[model samples]
Target: MASDAPADSVPALPDPVSRARLVDAVRFDRDGLVACIAQQHDTGEVLMMAWMNRTALEETLATGRVTYWSRSRAALWRKGETSGQVQRLIDLRLDCDGDTLLALVDQTGVACHTGRRSCFYRAMRGDALVALTEPEADPAELYGR
Candidate 1:
């Protein structure tokens, strides 16, 4: 049955709160991507930073796993998919402007493909860059490459 009132006369319905609303809140850059920093949930150690397109973000949120947009591969890359170092999302937060995201996760195994716990293993010494930490596992062993 059709309503007697015209469409314009009806009061506006409240938008249902949904996960899509959270995704919509993010402000993607020109390339439809945002920077997402992955951090260790309990240790407070930064694991890595990567880009996430809408699809990656949505999938991560829906699955409670960490995913990123691989600019190099031009595809959505699920962390630890091949290396057995998956990051299970504990929480996801956005910066004040909603331009960046922080993914706190429970990381299994090494987070870096280089077999390091983190990508940030380098530091600047007095005169040159240096490796602050050694790889926990061999790269070849981690990726089986």
Candidate 2:
């Protein structure tokens, strides 16, 4: 979820001590990335799931915007950079195991790359996969052909 505020004006993060503690609490996978579940802060809707490395988590904390490490691109990706469907971080939570992350965010637009509200738009019914919703916008239109 995104805010109307400018991206550069995000609030300052906690001090170094607190930041260090927070970072140290997380346990990354072999690839140094944790699975992050993004949910809509206000609606409590699960938007999407992504991977976040230490750098991505730190950047998100500092910027109040969600960032992820793109496995395909092998680099950091700030949400909404291309599709204008930004996610503004509201809160970050760590599971008891410290192996996963939950990010409460204010989503500005559709969360799915396919231009759907969410990536989990399909459901299994009687051993058949059924689409629960149609794309709100065309992917080609949103991301360019």
Candidate 3:
């Protein structure tokens, strides 16, 4: 049986042809959710991981922006709506098994709630991981400003 993946972990992107095949079909398993990885289009840096239901997936493809089902809010959220840190979709990829997705995006600003450029701002040091930087912008400022 497949194990539960670590939070925010992403399996590497597959090759173009193989990825294309999976994306075209886009079949999800019984859970009604698909694992999605947000990746920086130019540098290939992974930004975050989120879940996408069918509606979120379709909206993302149609709108050319990265969208995800916000489990916390229980609603569909287009990235950067509040923070103006939009991620424009460049391409979409799917895993070999077609159960997961990768969104290649042109990210404008922070992709993490903590205001890091990527969600993976922590680095593994000898026995522990440490945060590398402070948030560039304030999260409260994003609410209305």
Candidate 4:
């Protein structure tokens, strides 16, 4: 927790840099990766949740595109590279806790690997959980083996 210093104790910058500053300003795990939540800017729909390391974060900000660290592949992946359903970052924001990221994006086509418009297309009604939409396209067609 930060100390309750004077209201203007620390000035705010539209953007931040420096290792120590980034460490103190943003919260990240020991692995240098932070949990990122992607949402549709216009619809307010949660598209996906993924991890972003410092490199990925910087790359996203620098390129105006969303890049994420692929946990399974152990590599950096540009979203929609194969599917053509790319997420164009409208804004990148941090929560008060600084532990999580909220990405406001303008998404094209489907945003889920399952070929859904959004990754979270399931609804919980009482004890029943139901899928909302059919797959827009086959996963294999978007991402090959």
TM-score of every prediction relative to native: 0.87, 0.89, 0.77, 0.78
- Candidate 3 wrong stretches, greater than 4 Å: 1-24
Candidate 4 Cα misplacement greater than 4 A, ranges:
1-24
lDDT score at residue 68, model 4, on the 0-100 scale: 92
Among these predictions, the greatest TM-score belongs to 2
lDDT of 2 by residue, 89-135 (tens): 88888999999999988887799998998898999989999999899
Q: Per-residue lDDT of 1-145 in model 3, one digit per residue for the tens?
A: 0111121222232344543454457777676778899999889898999988878877666556677889889899878877778777777877788888888877776888877788888888898888877888777775563
lDDT of 4 by residue, 1-145 (tens): 1111122312232354632354456688898889999999988989899999878887666555677999899999878776667777777778898999998887777889998888888999789999988998788887784
In TM-score terms, candidate 4 sits at: 0.78
C-alpha lDDT of all candidate models, in order: 0.81, 0.85, 0.73, 0.75
Error of 2 at 6 (Å): 3.5
lDDT for each residue of candidate 1 in 25-107, tens digit (9 for 90 to 100): 99999999999999998999998999999999887776676779999999989887777788877778889999999988888
Clashes found in each candidate (C-alpha, N, C closer than 3 A): 0, 4, 0, 0
